[model samples]
Target: MRLVESRLTLTVSYALLALFAFIALFPIALLVLNSLKPAAQIVQNPLALPETIRWENFTNAWNHARFSTTFLNSFIITGTTIVLVCTTSSLTAYVIARRKIKSWKILTFYLLATTTAPIQLYIFPLYFGFAKLGLINNIFGVALIYTALYSPFAVMLLRTYFIAVPKELEEAAIVDGATHWQVFWRVMLPIVSPGILTVALIIGLNSWNEFLIAITFLQKQENVTAVIAFFLLSGQYSSDWGEIMAAALIIVIPVVALFVFMQKRFIEGMAGGSVKG
Candidate 1:
């Protein structure tokens, strides 16, 4: 009886997990399915498999969205933001973790508060300022905005990783006549690299998918990011649902591929930073 009950419990657990997995994947499956169908077919039956696969949808999406240019813009913004955030946040996290400052708690609180605060509060002001500075359609300018918006969270997350490093390592490096910069650059950064990779992946994903700030600051056609380009594919009166789905799929592919590739390091970083010593 006991053995039977255990088998039953295990079966039920697997069943529930499979159900949740299906639920999570269903929308993505639908998106891929619809991308190969005609717009009229999708309207008639989204669940039905395409009678004739439409490979041209992908080509049409790429051309109509001008992904060639917009993808380059996205890469520029994402790369710049990642570099700036990682460089600054790692330094800041190291200082906060290693230094014995009384106001560190206050600074941490401020970062936490800012992370929760809505970007909507500052959007108008930021737009006006960027316009005055002639940065409205500048890729680098948008990157700077992403850096500021993302840095607080990056600093807070990296602080935990820095705190997890053994203090004796820093002391030993210092005793060997290493300067503070050398200690931080040569010793601490390498140990905390997984955390940095994790941060980069996160910031890259956010920067790529971010629409509001991208659309607002990059008004010029040539400067728009891929997300903005994808958004522009929809018409006020009508939209090609197949092409739209194809565009959406194209946008998601890079992000998904990247996450799959870096998932191991990302997991390690998250686990490493979970507990502070």
Candidate 2:
């Protein structure tokens, strides 16, 4: 009887998980279905498969959105943000992880507090200051903003990896006549690299999909990211649903591919960080 009950429970759990998966994937299925249909067909029956697939929707969207240019702009911003976040946050995380100083504790708390704080709290003053300095529409400037906003979270995340490293390694490095920089570069960094890769993927995804900050800072047509370009496809009076979906898929495919390929590293880094030493 116990064996039968265990089998029943396992079956029920699988059924529930399958149901949840369908719920999550249904919208994405609809988006893919509609992306191949014309606007007229979408209006007629959104759920129905297209009788004739319109491959031209992608071409039209590519041209209309100026994806060639916008994609390059997004690459610059996202790549810049990733590099900045990783470099700075790794150093900050290392210091916080190793130091037992009171000031470091306070600094960690301050960064945590800022994570919970609303962006609007400082965006106005920051925006106005940047505008005064003529930093608006500058890709590098927008990257700086992303670095400030996202680095705190990255630091917090990376600290876990650093904390996991054995302190004896750093001491041994010092005893071997290695300087602090050498100790960090040779000993700590290699160990925490998985965590860094995870941080890079998460930060890159956020930077690519970030709408409000990107739209606000990158106003010029030539400077806007792919997300902004996708947004411009729609307007108050009208929208091209088919093309909009196509554009969304374009932006999503690469990110999804990256995640799928690197999912092991991402999961390992996150899981490793959560285990208590």
Candidate 3:
């Protein structure tokens, strides 16, 4: 009787999960299918399979959208942001966690407290400041802003992980004549490999898909994918829904792929293992 109940519960849970998955994927699948159909055919039968494939949709979307340049700009912005956030946050976290200094603790608290209530409405001043500095439409300028914006949370993440890291490992290295820099580089970083990767993935995804900052900071017609895609999809050619949906699908794929690849690292990073002194 217990075995039958367990089997029934497992089957019901899987059925619910499968139903949810189908609901989520059905729309995406419909989009991809319709993207291959002619507009006439799409309107005639939106749910029907393509009578003939229209591979030109992707080609048109790619060239017209300047997807290569968009991808390049996004990569540069995201890559730079990831590097800065990881380096600065890790250093900040290490200091806050390892030093045990009062000032450092106070600073950590101040930084972490920002996460409780963010100043979302105060960015207009910064926007005007960036425009005056001639930083608008520049990828590097956007990346710099993103790095600063994302680093506080990153510091909190790394600080928590660093607090859990045993100091004895670094201490032993210090006793054997390792300098603080050497200890940090050789001992601490290796042990926090998963956490570092998690932060990189998080910051990278955030920067990649960022809509408001990209739209606001980048004004050049050719500088931002998020801006370009938004305008393209929102234009009067609302009749050309296939291309719009295809573009959306393309842009979403990379971030989804990154998250899936790093989900394990993220989970392990936040599992909160003990820190020894």
**Which lDDT values do the candidates have, in the order given?**
0.88, 0.88, 0.78
C-alpha lDDT (0 to 100) for residue 45 of candidate 3: 86
lDDT of 1: 0.88
Alpha-carbon shift of residue 276 in model 2 (angstroms): 8.8
Q: Give the TM-score of candidate 2.
A: 0.92
In model 1, the runs with Cα more than 4 Å from the true position are 1-5, 100-102, 235-238, 267-277
By summed lDDT, the worst window of 10 consecutive residues in model 3 runs over 268-277
Which stretch of 10 consecutive residues in model 1 shows the poorest summed lDDT? 267-276
lDDT per residue for candidate 2 within 162-242, as digits (tens), equals 999999999999999998899989899999998898899888988989988888888888898988988887552127788
Pick the winner on lDDT between candidates 1 and 3: 1
How does each model score on TM-score?
A: 0.91, 0.92, 0.87
| Best model number under TM-score | 2
Backbone Cα, N, C clashes tallied per candidate: 0, 0, 0
Model 3 C-alpha lDDT versus the unseen true structure = 0.78
